[model samples]
Target: MVDQSAPLPSVCDLAIWEPVLRLTPEDGTERGAGRSARVAGRISPSGYSIAHRGSMPSTARIAVQDIQRELARGGVREVVFRAEVRPDGLTTLGLVWPSPAVEPAYGSVNLGVLVLADGSLPAPWLRRPDPVPGAVPAPSADPELLERTLRERLPDAVGATEEEIAAAEARLGVTLSDELRVLYRVAGGDWADDVETAIRVDKAVGCEIFGVEHLFGIDAASRFPGWDLGATDAIRTPPDAVVQGLAGSPGWIGFGTNGGDVFAVDLTPGPRGHFGQIVLLGHTESLGAEPVADSLTDFVLGRLREERPDRRGAELPAVAGVGTGRLASVQAAAHPALEVLSLDGGDGPPFHLAPVAGLPRLRTLTAMPGALADPLEVAGLTALEFLALGVQEWRVLLDAGAVPRTLKAAAVTVRHQDHLPVVPVANEILALWDRPRIAQTLLEGDLGPAAAPA
Candidate 1:
């Protein structure tokens, strides 16, 4: 039998670690010859760190995804990993299997909302495609011109059959726009691999066009707006706005990418938008798509351009932050349309929720430790559905039975404390909803001191 003591390949593999210890920002503390890392963050070469995140660089991320799936197949809901390096050159690693709540610490792709017994989704995820009862295609929508232009560009390319095109539409449960229908009829994307497909599409169509079989509706699920971030998103489609600021829309037919973003055809127009306008959905950002051109015709005719529309003074802001460099206080962030408000407890004074008390749309509040003047002040934000606070604040609420019953999810935020202690608090919050508790099993192992660098 093979030696079972060897480490199982997982995200916890220290060999795959990035310079995270390098990116952690300095905290006026120093590690002597070997005192271990003084602080934590995404370590960088500058003796500081970036945000805590999973692996990037594609390769590492894919490996993490594969391992997570394997773990899930084995009935693991979540895995929380911890690595401690001591001044004596001893490193200890711990793995918490089947964590009760979906831990977001590192190498996690499960960004969905906390489980609710009724399976209710956050407000942002509840959006459906708005009806454009009498909307017509934008004036620039010229299917004939688009087809002629594409056919001219790819004379030798193969076109998708009428039956094939219909099959794709049927699978997506929506009819394709005339220009898009014509575009595919001329030449449906054909490539053996994603890399070659991207290369071919970039050269043939000025961007990466998904194959006929790859077409999909850019709905909320595609973005995976987990509760942590989704709860804070607000829908703001002003009467004059061109693109509705929504989590997603059924009318949005996603057909291509700019490598890191998506391009879609809008079937559900905003109050001022035209049907069949071309829009871009940035993969890195949350919610909403931005208009790139008036129509698919314009998009292919050298009118292709991506300019971020000015949302400032154009619509009501949806998310706000209050802290030392952010809004002066809760009063400054108050608005009838506000949805997510985050308070940072940097070096600034504490904040009072009095200014934002009773705001109808407020649903998610994330207050760092010491950020709130009074932990009980949160009781007044009656509309809150997801609240994240420091352990002490949660303790106060847990003790007073003052936790907002409206909360569908809650989290205990901590900076320097080990996660083992936080599990109980998270379980306490989950108990309020009669939801499943976060369960942690500690498995520890030690690796002798690090080897000297060559």
Candidate 2:
């Protein structure tokens, strides 16, 4: 039998192979190269199984023990980890931390090293580094408009004067987030977007910003990996799956507004505040100036300041901006079946449709007064769910003037609309989505037009 100690063969001699791996904690120290060691498995570096002509030698067994010891050192613990194999058959090491509070998705990670039977090393074990506490994913290139908006436009409006804040409060009915209030009070909103397309705190706050009272939102990709953050039109890009952001950095976000625009901020007092990418709520035709943009910013800034240093929280004012009224009106016309959606100017389509077509869920959708002029694209959603459609947003009822076979519970309502002319093709529309029966049974009569002009 070949003596195991007889100088081990090079990695080229093994018929099957397996990789050597390393694991580290969230804030673990950088591992040294001496950590590398070999195992007893007589395998190749590129494969998982191993074989040999004779029994394993004492030296090989000892090497495996040493490797295991190094892997489990410090805060790093050893555990079985799997990676999604690519077409090329190569695998990348995924690092996972022990805490359920961090990188929970990757509960355990396979270290990064390919060990040879002879104790030779293929490469250094690698792992992902933690991101800056409040880093916001920014476009590789600077977004000129976003920069100007954050730095110049917002600062100028915010710094106007105390009179400005008072006037804004009167105009827009709602109070602002504490962070926004601080900005308005301190720099008077005079600021610059130092991070180009992305936003970050000028400094880091030692405390976590997740649940600061009156602070409202503090979203991080590390916290919510599933968040979608591509420019509306950039949905096809791969990075959209792993973009980072503050809680309200735009895109479609749920602030627990419970179907309203009212959102909260992080209650924790920190320097990071809510500095991150956010889709500007206004700035487009999505919604008319129901809420004055200036006032909303002030209210939010004031709220932010009150929470800083040491200050008492104030009662949020009962204010209704234009956004609320517009949303309310839009909701009135919203029908679960035929919904009209609006996209923030900068935000693209709804995330649910990303893998499908590219459209964000619209906050306000008004339904048409009568027969659908065009067929609606709603493959992403299953039937029976409610869809909101805005007025004047025509949808094709069918192709080739034919109705759909599946639409039964769909209904249409018009918000902020009154005294419209009768629909010209209500009967034809009923025949399209195969809704004639629904029209007669559910609609309760003729697929007739509204008595007034639409």
Best by lDDT: 1
Tens-place lDDT per residue, model 1, 1-454, is 1122323334355444333222222321223334454222221112212233443345534444565565555544444444455544344443444433453433222222344445456677767767788778888889988888887877766767899899998998888889889878886856655565446545666677888988888767667556666666666777787887677777788888878999999988788788898888888766777888889889888686566666434223468888867777788889988888999959778888998888888988988778889989888898887888887888899999998888776667765534335656776777877776654433333334444433
- lDDT for each residue of candidate 2 in 323-390, tens digit (9 for 90 to 100): 22233322232343222233221122221222222223221121333322233544433321222222
TM-score of each model, paired residue for residue: 0.71, 0.18
Task: State which candidate has the highest TM-score.
Answer: 1
**Candidate 1, position 143, lDDT:** 91
Q: lDDT of each prediction vs. the true structure?
A: 0.66, 0.25
Candidate 1, residue 11: the lDDT equals 39
* Deviation (Å) of 250 in candidate 2: 18
